[model samples]
Target: MYTETPAVVMRQIKTVNGRRMIVLFSRKYGKISAGTSISESGKNKSALALRPYTYGRYELSKVKDNFYINGAEVLRSYYRIGEDVDKYLQASYVLEFTDKLLPEGEPAEALFDLLTEFLSMMEERKQAYGTLVLGYLCQAIAWSGSAPDLGVCSGCKDAEVKYFSVKDGGLLCEDCAGKAVQDRRLIFPVTVDIIDVFNYLLESPLKSLHALALREDLEKKVRNILRSYIAYHLGIEELKSESLIV
Candidate 1:
């Protein structure tokens, strides 16, 4: 049987001999490994559509349990994102997160749309790379069902939120903060603005984030807080593309 769906190329396309393969994150199928043949006559229509960051409708042929790229039509080529080294690296981190966190065969249309929106914005090169990525991470976390509650404290339901407990997966009140540390849970102090920003990112659509401006100081803080939260929950020690940002 054949299926078609909206998808984004998730990694550098791989080639072996005349065979080309790609990893794609699709709205219908989540993550999938697929391939196609590049004709020796060089008349393959799917070539450009298979390139990294290409968003399009992909047609795949399923044979028993495996799928191959039968053809595709490019909808939006995020070509500009690769023009700047910083944008490329930052965008790569978002791709890596999707590739690593999302499971195969599980559909996540919301996250897929979020990724496409992020790439579209990144291609324009208007926002700072750090700020854009931080917002994406927050959205990604929420979509993955591991969103940290930034509202009133999750522990006491009273007093202002002071720290984020990754283990508990939410904000901790000042009183609960001490016990969280004693319990050896990963706790990071958070400011009101930081919490508010994360809360916004979690609930708002991608375009809504454009109005919020972030300074370099606050950008770094948000990065650290979200990174720590992701690492502790997802068990990722470090993001490879992160080192490439600077």
Candidate 2:
């Protein structure tokens, strides 16, 4: 069967006989791996669409259980993302992170649209790349249904929360924090600023990220907290592109 869909080229691996396997996060089919002979150097629409940081319409042929890319046309390409090393690494980290979050053949249209918006915004962003990354991470985690409880204490449901407990999966009250520490669970003391940053990122749209900027200290602190949170809940320890970012 043959079908066409809008997709982002996530990653590509070289296969035998010069053919390549392309991983795509498609709007219609979610994540799918398709084999194709199209070369990035070829002067054709399909070839251009095969490159990274591209959003394109792909024509795929499914044979029994496998998919092959027949043709494609670039809808939009954030090629400029590669111009700066910082921007490129950040963009790569998100793409890789998204690939890990998605299950094969499962359609996640919300995530698909979020990625599209992320790439569009990142392409034009000039500073505070970490802020954008943090926003994307918060939104992505929420969409994945594992968002940390920020409204109130995850334990005891107390309105007054002072710390974030990774094991409890959210904010913790002072008492809960003491108990968590006694239990040897990992927890971080959070300020109102930290909690507010997370709340804003989770509730606001990606486009609004431009309005928010965090001091380097605050951004790193939140990033570390989310990293540990994601590792515990999502089972993702570290992404290869993560080290490339900073």
Candidate 3:
């Protein structure tokens, strides 16, 4: 059986047998793995499509429950992301995070689009990479159905929010904030601007995020906020590629 799907190469791991196993996040089949003997010598048609950061249509053949990449055509490589160290590292983190969070064989169409948009934009982006990354992180979390509520206080619901509680999964009202202290929940005061920016990132499209502006210091803060939230919720201690941002 053969199938074709739109996919992005999330990763490529080399097997002991010298073949490459590509982990693809596909629009149709979600996350999947297929082995290919495609060499990177520019002689194989599937080689470029199999490289990480390449988005393309992948043709796969199924044999005894395993899939092999029969052929592929690269749509957008986003290869420029490798031109700069900062872009390369952050972009790598984006793919790493996506690979880590999404479950195999579960299709998330919105997430697939979001990732493609993110990679496309990242390729040409010089500034606002941090903001773009934060936006992607927020959208990815939301798409995964683990988004923290940003509207009402997650604790008291109706009260005005004063702080964000990672343990509670969202903002908390003053009353709830005091209670959280007693219960030893980790909480941090949130500025209105931070809330507004985060809300915008969560609701806006990836293209709009390219023009989004924030003071340099605030950008770092927001990055930490989303990173901490993801780490707490997803159990990811730290992204390996995060060091390049600083």
Candidate 4:
């Protein structure tokens, strides 16, 4: 039996010894790794198709009970991502996060589409990459069932002006957050508002985000809360790409 699946090129690592692996985000099967090898020369067609962030059509074939990429064709090279240092790092972070968050072979059409849209947004959009990334993160997390609950204060349920609890998922009204809790970071009103902005921007037309204005102070606070939330859910101390911030 054989299966044909649609996939996004998450990344690729090439070794001098001819060991090559392509990390792929597939629509039907989720994240996967496929081995590919060609002549040592860089002119190999298979090598070209599996480069990082290159969306393409591929044929996965079974060899010794393992799935390997036997052939492929480049659909979009995503050329601009590698042209600049900031762009390259951001793109890498997105791909790395996707690989870590999504499980393999789970059939996620929504995720597949979002990832494809992300790369396109990165390569073509000229606006603030930070805003674009944050907006997508909020939406993507929501889609994955880990969305921070911002509808009501986690503590008081007041649904009014409040402080956010990263350890508790989202905002907490004064009454709810009055009790002492360790590592409970304060979320200022501006931070809450910027979070709303990112949420709103995610739903806004793609054309609008190109000119989106993300206030530095507010954006920073919003991102801090988001990072804390992600760490709480994933139980990670830190993100590797966070250091890549310039």
Candidate 5:
């Protein structure tokens, strides 16, 4: 089958002979491998669309058993991400974490939109970049069905939670924490308001993210929980793009 469709670059590869890139978690095929040629390289590579985090339209076809990208047109390079160091790192974090968390060819349009929105947020202007990313992660995980059950205390039926458990799922009021942490625990309280904010970012307009306040400590807390949860589910120590950030 030959098709021209929108895609995002999840990974880029360079070998002594040939150049290739993997577009995982695509909205169309779920995952894809696109072959490239060196002739496309220069100051302005037509294949920049194959660079990680580059969102654009691609011309792809199945040749024998493998899928190859015969051509691509870059729609948004998210180039501003490279100028700011913090934005750059967080963008890398987003890519690395998402690349692992999403299953290949799983039909995730929400995931794709979520990723582009994050890049768009970074490109425009965001004072609380960390919080922005964390909130997006929270919603993405929830959308992917791995989100922690933050609705009620994981241990007790207390309506309000004073802490969170990464190993278990989410917030656990004092009573729940005591009984639930035999194996592992993360103690924290994420406000119902925070969850609401997460939902908005995931489902609402990407532009709305600019207005939210990012609590620094809570931002880190959310990231910690989401990253651990994703790592646990994927059973991988590192994502291919981890080096792009760390």
Candidate 6:
């Protein structure tokens, strides 16, 4: 069977036989691995569409249980993201992060749109790349249905919360935090600023992130907390592109 759909190139790997296996997040099929002999270096539209960070329409032939790329055309190529090392690394990290969140054969249309919007915004961003990354992370977690509780304390449902508990899966009130687990690593003390930022990121659209500037210190703190939270709840311990970001 032959099918065509809008897809984002998540990553590519080379097989021992020299064929490139492309991991694509498609609108019709969530995540899929398709083998292709098409050379990315070729001076053709299909070749250009095969590289990472390119959003394109792909034509694939499914034989029994495997998929092979027959052709493709770029819809939008975030080629400029590669111009700066910082942007490149951050963009790469987002792709890796998104890849980890996606499951095979399930359609995630909302996330597909979010990923494309993130790439579009990241391509034109000049500074505070981490802020954008943080926003994307928060929104992605929400899309995955594992978003941390922010409205009230996850433990006791108290209105006054001071910490974010990864194990408890959300905000923690002062009283609850006092009686929670002894593992200090599972609890992160949060200020009003941090809570406000999390709420904003989760509630606002990705396009508005360009105007928001989060303090450098705050960004790092939130990133660390989110890293730990995702690791515990999602079972994603590491991302190769994460180290490449900074």
Q: Positional deviation of 118 in candidate 5, in angstroms?
A: 1.7
Better structure of 2 and 5 per TM-score? 2
Clashing residue pairs in candidate 4 are 29-105, 155-176, 156-176
Residue range 1-246, candidate 5, lDDT tens digits: 898778778777665466655654466876666666634355454556677778888877877767777777788889998889888887787777777766755667877887887788888865777767766766766777775665677676688776667677666787777677345534445666555554465465555667776676655555565566666655645655445543
Candidate 6 lDDT score at position 48: 94
TM-score of candidate 2 against the unseen true structure:
0.96
lDDT string for model 6 (1-246, tens) is 999999999999998666799999999999999999997679899999999889999999999989999999999999899998999999999998888888887999999999999999999998999999999999999998888878889877889989999998889999899898658899999999999999899889998898877998999889999899989988886799887764
Q: Whole-model Cα lDDT per candidate?
A: 0.80, 0.91, 0.84, 0.71, 0.68, 0.91
Q: Residue 114's C-alpha lDDT in candidate 6? A: 93
TM-score of each: 0.89, 0.96, 0.92, 0.87, 0.82, 0.96
Model 4: per-residue Cα lDDT over 1-246, one tens digit each: 356576888767775678777778877677777777754246656667777778877788756546678777777888998887787787777777777788765777887887888788889866567777776777677777877666777766776746776767677777666773656454434346765775685456444566676888766777776777767785543567777863
| lDDT score at residue 1, model 2, on the 0-100 scale | 99
Q: lDDT score of model 3?
A: 0.84
**Cα lDDT for residue 108, candidate 1:** 87
Model 6 vs. true fold: TM: 0.96
lDDT tens per residue, model 3, 11-85: 888896668899999999889999888776664657778888999999999898688998999998887998988
Name every residue pair that clashes in candidate 1.
Answer: none
- Model 2 per-residue lDDT tens digits across residues 73-159: 999999889998999999999998998989999999999999999999999899998999999999999999998878889879999
Give candidates' CA RMSD values in order.
2.4, 1.4, 1.9, 2.6, 3.2, 1.3
* lDDT, model 4, position 221: 73
Which runs of model 3 end up more than 4 angstroms from their true locations? 181-185
Q: Write the number of the candidate with greater lDDT, choosing between 4 and 5.
A: 4
